[model samples]
Target: MDAKTIYAQSSDIKSRTYLEYRKDMKKKAIAELEILVWLKSKLSTLYPKQKIKVSKSSGDAFLWFLRKGGVTREPDYHAMIDDKDFDIEFQYADKIDLKYFDFAISKIAKKNKKTGKREPHQDRKILYILKNNHSFAFFNPEWVLKNGKIGFVDAWRKDAYRIPRNKFIKILESDPTLKSVIEMIDVKNYILNFQHDPIGINKEKLSFLLQQIIDEQKIIKIIPNDLDSFFKVCFILDNLNKAPQNINLWLVYLLSFISNKNTTEDLSKIIYCVDFLYSKTELKYNELKSLVNKVKECFKLLKSFEQKDGSFKSSVNLSPIDETRNAVFSINLLEDLTQDLIFYYKTKEFNPITKIYQNLNFIHNTYNLIKNLSMHYYIS
Candidate 1:
């Protein structure tokens, strides 16, 4: 069946996805008094203002400011006091802004040897903007507060386990949008993509390739052959189950099993029963090599399938939560596997430019994740 037909069959899905987002837009707006209160505190401490006007995507709401010859600006949150602009980002959003990552990671930069001068990084440029004749505070967001870390990505991503702790709450207390989102994550009701439009992949090609991946999963299935091994694996995964019917958990379970089998070198049945189609376990030497090559190819395919907004317009499950988030974790897993990448680089298959691009992509993707919160998780 055509995917568009399948999608069109369910009006409820689109409505449910978008309608909840509309409802949240009202709730998500930064409270006027809340910002006023924070600004008042900081203003009293550092810079004093006759009156502060909270800026928005559109022109500022202050009737006086409009009359005072102000223009619309792109700052996430900005203020005008004493006829000067203090454009700021009030670390009050869900995903850390990538601009903040641009600030932290380039803490030290590579200098130009010829010029004998310190090279400037992107964050330094932002700092320059702030420290100009008139200054502004960046209003430190949660990601910056934690010092440029991934947040709630998956069990494999370092920040996932660490973020749920209580210490991160203070960064969010000032903004109701940030505070309410944390409340939602606490209860497991945070709708990460409910507000965004679906970024479509090539439906026909994606559907075909998606079916292929599913067939591969069955062919190179990860569950152990032994009933005892199966139960042991199940016990561990059962303990880690945080959400109901979460297929992401299954992907992690398979990965855990695969991780335990990395040592298999021979054409051995790697801690598993044979898949008749693939003949041997994924961990077997030749079999693993073949699969890794296949995986490398699929990475290209997956990148092609990815939408500009970094979402695939498909699902492997019908669970209530967005499956695209799980898809992102899959991307991160594939990306984080340095072993495959090292092997690929050593094989001398890719051109010099491709190799350099592949190396730089890790940092690029990490910062990209910071800006796009759809798949990324909120820490507090």
Candidate 2:
């Protein structure tokens, strides 16, 4: 079946239950205020001569200032320690998208109101406070960009680097200025005492919930697999009588196993799994090489499927709507991976100039189709 038919059939399907649960989980992991309070007290002592001020910074005027500097998303808090400006953000996840670092480094050329000439925006340091297990870890964007390993993050749908908890611990323990602050506060005890939402649901309850979602949303035939294989895997996992440590990561693997073939969806699943594993484990050179090789293979396959008309031919026959949607999704994923390779990894195999022209042509054709062709069908 084509993407359009499947989407049309499942258009009314609801995912509110699962979405609500995720929303609740996010709200309960509140750490921004506590972290800011601690930083204010500790930093004042660390730098006695320097002035320190920190506060929530999402007022209209501040947001306007950030927009002028080319930032769309507002950081949770702004801190001024001595003369240095810092944008502080707290995240419940161990990893952060590399794009944030890119944004930090990029200086937008904005016209100066007084001089009427383009001038570079002032740079501010980004401080990320990430949650790991029961504690928090601090990440300096500059340090991370220099030493961090970038990988595809499934949650954010972008390539990111992990902010390991141990690194922060080491900094607190070894750094002379920070060592005193560690003595002044009980970091571990404070974090452990922080209120957390308990997982009241057991394996049986979780299985029941999963089954309900599968039925209600009619998500039985998720991507990279058909109905039979999807159900088979679900049944096998259900019989195990044990919940997978990472439910989403397990599903990615389950879907890959069911497919037993390479497709654009399979490529995405591979990247997702790789991202999950890399976050938990140390970076291995051999594994990284293997992942790059797989990326090259997928790139070659996608290029083969590209048609002369700037549209990609789907592996299975699809209607114009379905094909266009699928092709656009595949192209977006391909472009993301290609940029990661060219910019971060510095791979010479791919030509950026050639891709630039190809993407421009694809964009032009898509724009024409949406403008001229779709206009004919408009009701008003």
Candidate 3:
């Protein structure tokens, strides 16, 4: 849809327009493309002898959200070195979460419509570009199955193999050819010069920002439209090793922000802010009571939006991914906070986070239906 159309549809959300969201998406698309082009050129330059070819693969779901979004898509590009096929995924993440990688691999493994052949099997060589650090790794579902053990990943709210980063690094380093590629991929120092500084308040200004946000008198003056500034303040506070004092007032400000008018974006941010606050310190007495009540209230509201299939309703009704993703985050945080025994009596109904598993099951079932239909069509 056009910018104005998207914006009109998504006006219910916080200050950010769908046009701005699309613009951000476009910027990410361009940045990733630029990185891909640069990586291809660098690889070609570094190994003139080796038959290095990095071409854009059709599998990458760069902006499928803007398209007819229903199911999710994995982003992938192809690389052929000495005729050895490897599927490369470039992503921006602070740390490696193997469940997502596993899910992406599952998505990548698709059946050919006419031929009924499973393309890009799990055994296919997979490499990752951790964009945050500009580091590279060898990670595939085959490798994960063989090497890693199952454990719960809190972020994904699913069990993933608890593989060490060192193991992935070892694979990248063990092979002489792969090691050479890794060496060439070490563009951190080279890329840092061109990188823009992260946008947020600096460490020095954090204390001052906190004082302003938690300041009971002035904090109420901040209109809902100006909550982005409050977000920046929360960002700084969340990063701090020590918990901010006078958190009760901070929470009151957060709770006040919650209203029926608040959109999914607003709700998710407030949920995250609450989660971040609870994580930093031990709350007791009225502080604990206030926090627990807020969580329960939020959970009730979240349940109102929950679909029978586990996906949450979106105001825009454009994409399930947009609202469902935020809902997942909120649920995860709620699930985490309610883990304590003190919260059990109050939030017993909301325990275990079965919706997350249900959501995964829903997605998988959809995939299976599509696969089976394709197979039946091909056979007929």
Candidate 4:
């Protein structure tokens, strides 16, 4: 009953409580105000019909089209006016929808693995009129699916609004500034124009987040689907800031693909270990990226076997290996790649960031000491 173990137990309890609260809350009301701001403006030209019908959020045909595309939020309005029918979905980024973009791309899992039967029929949504806070953006299903990436300026803020059929091109022509924003957008500071900027990624914030994870022994308590404490801290910090940078954002993005009980421990150690390896070879960053790709594949393989139960299992071609070991290995590989990228800007170059990276020498030493503990799992 060590302190770390105790922390892990209580943290797990808290997580369960939080998850319960999360499930209890569902979107019962549509974001009508946001939707109306766009839809009412278009009624004159789009639908010339005499019949006007507006109903509350209903997960129905055409309405369900959103559901098929992975959008679970009920559309604010499913309306029929002069026999013209349409659905409008409103989204406020940095608020209700973290993965809201996913809803615009693919159809939900079409067939069940065990039954191999087609799922229920749902509407196929093509164009989505979206509001990103005060401003609005258009979503094109075909373009998103073809590209497999969402551009930040795809949803507009600080730009003029238009209901153009070719949203991307129209946006480009309508607002050059938004075009510039899209060109410049990265993983952080994307679609959501954050309201505040208290902290941006640097070594100090990274250290604070990592320490939170280590102190709480989050690595020791990770569940199959739960996010790591270090990563969770990143999200919390990110939510506070309006425009977050790529450093911590990229860290969590790459780290999240793999999961394990020791994910936190492995990542904590690997961050430093990678730095050491980088110093020896001094390889270029692009070369490091290529190496990290291999690690991602390994994680993909390990993640594939995650079962209905929490435990990892063997697939036909894959061996049944320990999930934690593979996760640690993946973490090590990513750490080796990320060491230099994280510290790209100098401490004096950016205030407070350097402080976080400072005073963390013990993490490297701790990794060295407990490196052999992994051997126990190896032997067993």
- lDDT top scorer: 3
For candidate 4, write residues 1-380 as lDDT tens digits.
12232121112222222212211221211223223423454544344646566543442111211201233544455666776665544433322233323332223214557898534224422323222222334443333444334333345332222222343333321222222222222211211111011123323344343322323334323322323433343333323221123343333343444344333334433332232223334334554564355344444554554443323343343232333233333333342233323343111211221111121223233233233444454687
Model 3, span 274-377: residue lDDT tens: 76555455556677667667777777677777766645675874345445556655654455455432333343333432121222324433333334544565
TM-score of 1: 0.24
Give Cα-based local distance difference scores for all models: 0.31, 0.40, 0.48, 0.33
* Cα distance off (Å), candidate 2, residue 359: 4.5
Q: Which runs of model 2 end up more than 4 angstroms from their true locations?
A: 1-283, 341-361, 370-380
Model 1: per-residue Cα lDDT over 1-380, one tens digit each: 22211111111112222223322432333232234344445555456546655443233222111111232233334566667655453323334322332332223233568987444332221211111112223333334424444344432343321233233333232333234323323222122233122222212323333322112223223544443344233322222221123333333333333432222110011111111112111244544454455445534544443455434434344221233343333343243232333333333332221111132233233334434553444432
Candidate 4 has its poorest 10 consecutive residues by lDDT at 190-199
Which wins on lDDT, candidate 1 or candidate 4?
4
Q: Which segments of candidate 3 are over 4 A away from where they belong?
A: 1-226, 240-242, 317-319, 341-380
Per-residue lDDT value at 246 in model 2: 47
**Residue 85, candidate 3: alpha-carbon lDDT:** 68
TM-score of each: 0.24, 0.32, 0.35, 0.26
Residue-level lDDT tens digits of model 2 in 215-315: 21232234324433333333323233222344444443443342224444444334433332332333245444555565566556556655655455545
Best by TM-score: 3
Between prediction 1 and prediction 4, which has the larger TM-score? 4
State each model's C-alpha RMSD to the native. Answer: 21.2, 21.0, 20.9, 22.4
Q: How are the candidates ranked when ordered by lDDT, highest leading?
A: 3, 2, 4, 1
